[model samples]
Target: MPPIAILVALADPTRCRLIELLQGGPQPVHVLAAAFRISRPAISRHLRVLKQSGLISEKKFGRENRYALHPGKLAPVQRWLAGLLPAARITEAPAVVIPAVEQPLPKARRIPKPAATPVILVPALAAEAAAPAPAKPAVSQMGFDF
Candidate 1:
């Protein structure tokens, strides 16, 4: 199966761009950050995600960390995509037919539904329902009540 981590890592636009940048050659975090409008920390986070997915490798050169692309990590993804192509599909073998014995299904027991009971309102509630609602105060065009 193709590494799902690679797909997850590539899902982000920042990470995708980071991969593209690394393709040319290994670059330090500050050099990669210079290419983007986002903060250096944000670029570092994207690089971290790519590293976790095994799509890129980090090498320390003195004080600076350079990230390089590992193209072989994408082989599984390529193979998985190749399988989806029309030409990659193999023809299926002929299926053998075997007659199955049929058995009658048992009848399901039916339960009678209960009739709904009528709702009875109390005298106090009925009186309240009969009373007219209070009229709302009239408001001017400015929305202020007199």
Candidate 2:
């Protein structure tokens, strides 16, 4: 798979969420859309991106299309990240052993003193209301008074 294409596809939040959902099994666009607030068309667009990136596989099931994760495409990404791990790197020499020092650690001043925060207490509202319930909208007496 094209690593850059896969990275670009997975970079989107919705695409990543869709990829997570696909892990359980293949799902049609409608089913995927139900898991999110976005419209079906938007979900389809995301699927297309994943497909173009070779990160997902799509199959036509009946009249609907089902999408599944193409995990192999992510192998490159995994390998790239794995290479960054210290343990994964090869060394010409054996592991070094450093002696432990008995020196006391420097004191930690973790929390700074609380600065004075100004408190503005709002005064209580007046008991009297602004006005009555809009004067009952001035009902028309054209027909008849109740």
Candidate 3:
């Protein structure tokens, strides 16, 4: 499995940026801390996490502690990711085309529809139809009927 510690160490934006800084070559803690707006102690804490993950190494030069990147430690992570992808085939199979055979569709039989009958209205029903309809209730934008 890919090193969970490496993933956890790189989870923080501060730690990721520290890795980027170390990529330039070994640098003293003071120089690395100067690259960020955070406190020196906070930078030291991030470096410690990276060291614990085996992603970086520290060397003492006089009173200063210089950190360097161990990029080879990331191979397990790369291998784990590559394993998730499907393998490519060296040779592809040739395509074969089959000729199409078309057949005529059968004719559909039609049935005649019955004619519509006329409607006659009585005088009382005619008067009611001539009368105006009642006004609908007012509706608000919220769908409430007033």
Candidate 4:
């Protein structure tokens, strides 16, 4: 899977929260949503994105779906990060930082700040003013709201 897709899925705060919950252990959709501040459907949408990204896997038990981390897909990401860090001490003796004359010190990588990105803020009253009256979905559904 493309890294961008995984990044996009987690770009949403709700999806990030859902992933955080699953990090502890597998959880039912209702249980996951309880930790979120959004509506049930909104959480469902976040879960959908997560499922598509291969970050999470869902198992159906009767009417409910239980989601868990997909470690197989996650291992590569972890390995990639581990590759960036300094290697472990070669011997039991206290490790010495012997600078190689051939290779200069590795430059620190600069990470962009998340806060530098633009954010869209919606005030309660302004949001309410922009809200459209409820339009029922075309199909009836039974789902849990935690």
Best of the candidates, lDDT: 1
Residue-level lDDT for 85 in candidate 2: 75
User: Number of backbone collisions per candidate, in order?
Assistant: 0, 0, 0, 0
Per-residue lDDT over 1-146 for candidate 2, one digit per residue giving the tens place of the 0 to 100 score = 33677788888888988887887779888888887766888888889989998989999989999998876687777776667675785333432323223466578888988999986544453333433555566788774446
lDDT of 4 at 45: 82
Judge candidate 3 at residue 34 and give its lDDT.
76
How does candidate 4 fare on TM-score?
A: 0.50
Evaluated against the true structure, the overall lDDT of model 2 is 0.76
User: What digit string (tens of lDDT, one per residue) describes model 4 on residues 1-146?
Assistant: 33566767767776766776776678898988776556889888888888998999899989999999764565544555556554742223332323222445578999876666665666867787678989987664443233
Candidate 1 residue lDDT tens string, 33-144: 8877779989988899899999999999999999999977987777777777857754433333232334666789999999999988898899888899999996566632
Off by over 4 Å in 1: 86-146
Candidate 4 local lDDT, residue 21: 70
> TM-score of every model?
0.58, 0.56, 0.57, 0.50
Worst 10 residues of 1 by lDDT: 92-101
In model 3, what are the clashing residue pairs, if there are any? none
Per-model C-alpha RMSD: 24.7, 20.7, 25.8, 18.4
Worst 10 residues of 3 by lDDT: 92-101
List where candidate 3 sits over 4 angstroms from the true fold. 87-146
Q: In candidate 1, how many clashes are counted?
A: 0
TM-score, model 3 to reference: 0.57
Worst 10 residues of 4 by lDDT: 91-100
